[model samples]
Target: MNIHLIAVPYDSAVRGWRMGAGPEALLRSGLEDHLRARGHHVATEIVEAPDDGPATEIRTAFVLAAALRDRVRTAREAGALAVVLAGNCGSALGTVAALAEDEPLVVWMDAHGDLNTPETSRSGFLDGMALAILTGHCWAPMAASLLPRPVAEDHVLLVGARDLDAGEQALLADSAIRLVHADAARAECRGCWTPHAR
Candidate 1:
């Protein structure tokens, strides 16, 4: 398979700090060579925000998302499996926008429920609102700017989420999005799982 590895090396829209270093670290660890050893052809691209670009997290995220959208679309057109290495979950908005078609099934694996909107977010972490943006619950304009369509809530499956904020928990309880607890996921893989309330 041909793999297009696009790296978004920014965390909180800022460059050269924190999680932003993750992409380079992964590359330095020989991710490309490992994939080649496994017989997959790899192409790489790195997304960098302008030094003088928007300083706010949300604004910077949108900028990165737009760039990612174009790159992901190009990879798809070239018949390559686009693999995005991103510093934060917010980069997923661009990925989903570029790839989603006819109600795509989103299997999100994470330790925390990234379902908080700006209104419900107590920590003010913009990455927490990524899923909300993808589903069009918040940041509609920003989301639409990248991709006009919103992924359906029923088609999203949240797996391995063990930590959730109060607002996120409340929202999940009232929403149609499916949840698979970490324990349940592990048990199911081992063929010893049973149905239970999330």
Candidate 2:
């Protein structure tokens, strides 16, 4: 299989800081070579934000998402699987938007629920709201600018999201999206023996 490894090395609008360093670090760690060893044809691309003045979390994130959307679309056109290595989970907006026409099912694997909206998030962290944006719970106009339509909650599966905020938990309980806690997922992996829930 052909793979397009798109890297977005930005964390909350800043470049190469904190989690932003992860994307390049993965490449330097021979990720491409490892994939090739596994018999996959791998190609890579780095996505960057513009140098226009100062960067705000919301603006820069959207810009990066738009750029990533384009690259992902190109990869799909060439029949290559587009795999994004991004620091911020919000970068998923790009990948989802690029595939919006297909109405794909989203299987999110993360420690945090990422289902917080601006109103529900105490930290005011944009990445915390990634899943909310994807499901049209918030940021409707901006999200719609990129995606033709929001992904249905029933089409989403949140796996191993053990660190959910109260608001996220409430939202999840009311939504159609399926949630598989970490312990239950591990139990499934181990067949008959289930790990004790913490």
Candidate 3:
């Protein structure tokens, strides 16, 4: 298998802080070497925020997402699996944009339900609205900038979500997106997996 690794080393709109360092940390931990040892061809690209960039978190997210979308598209054109190592969930928008042809099913595994919209969010955290953007719940202009295709709510499966705000909880209950609680996830996984007969 050929894998194209896209590294996003920024958290929210801020550069070089917090989760922003995760991608480089993973790379330093011999990720490339480990993948090569597993007999896969690997290529890497780093997506960085411009030195003079957007002033707001939302704008910054869109800028980075656009870059990631282009890179993902290029990777797909070259017949490589695009794997994004991102600092935040907002980057998922770019991944979805690149791959959402004929409405691809999205399996999102996150600690929080990242389904808050501008109207429902209390913390004012832009990253919290990433899933909403992907589902066309808000940020229509920014979402359309990358790609107009929005993953249908029914096609979204959110796993391992344990930290959700009241708004997020209410929204989840009303929406078609499937939720697999963190506690029950392991049991569900075990039930789904079966050993093949030799």
Candidate 4:
């Protein structure tokens, strides 16, 4: 199998994280080497870092989002599967929404649902609202562009969620992303879900 790695480091609309170094962490952790040993070919594309460090972190986040969308578009044109690891999951959501199709299911693997709209979002940061953006709930133009173009609400699924805000809750009640919280499972279910773990 051939897997393409895409990294989105920041979210203009959300709080920032050490997420910019996620690619470095994975490589240093031997993720690629291990994959190769398993006979899986791995190709990586880093979201080009912006040179505006002294600026507000929010500014840097928007720059990072654009770079990631460009990479994701390139990868999509080439027909490649992707794994986007970033702190602001909401930031890269546009890319994710653009890539989603009815063929393969997209499973948002995370502790937070990442689903909040700007209006519904208590936090103005876009990262917290990624799931909300991707599902086409509410967002800025750029973030909205990355979604399914008049996005379909039924194609999303959320697993391993531990938290969500009030507005996010209201939106979730209206959309199709099914959230399976962490504590709702028994040991047997957890064991069964391990293979699909993700």
What tens-digit string does per-residue lDDT give for candidate 3 at 24-45? Answer: 8999999999999999999999
What is the C-alpha local distance difference test score of candidate 4? 0.63
Candidate 2, residue 12: lDDT: 93
Model 3 stretches with alpha carbons more than 4 Å out: 190-198
What is candidate 4's lDDT per residue for 111-192, written digit by digit as tens? 8777776676676766676666655565556554444463456666777777878777777887776777777634427567
User: Model 4, stretches more than 4 Å misplaced?
Assistant: 11-17, 49-63, 76-80, 100-105, 148-150, 185-188, 193-198
**TM-scores of the models, in the order given:** 0.90, 0.92, 0.90, 0.72
Best by lDDT: 2
Which residue pairs come into collision in candidate 1? none
lDDT of 2 by residue, 77-172 (tens): 999999999998999999899989999899999999999999999999999999999999999999988889999999999999999999999999
| Alpha carbon lDDT at 144, candidate 3 | 83
Model 1 misplacement above 4 A: 51-54, 191-198
Report the lDDT tens digits of candidate 1 across residue range 27-51.
9899999999999999999998767
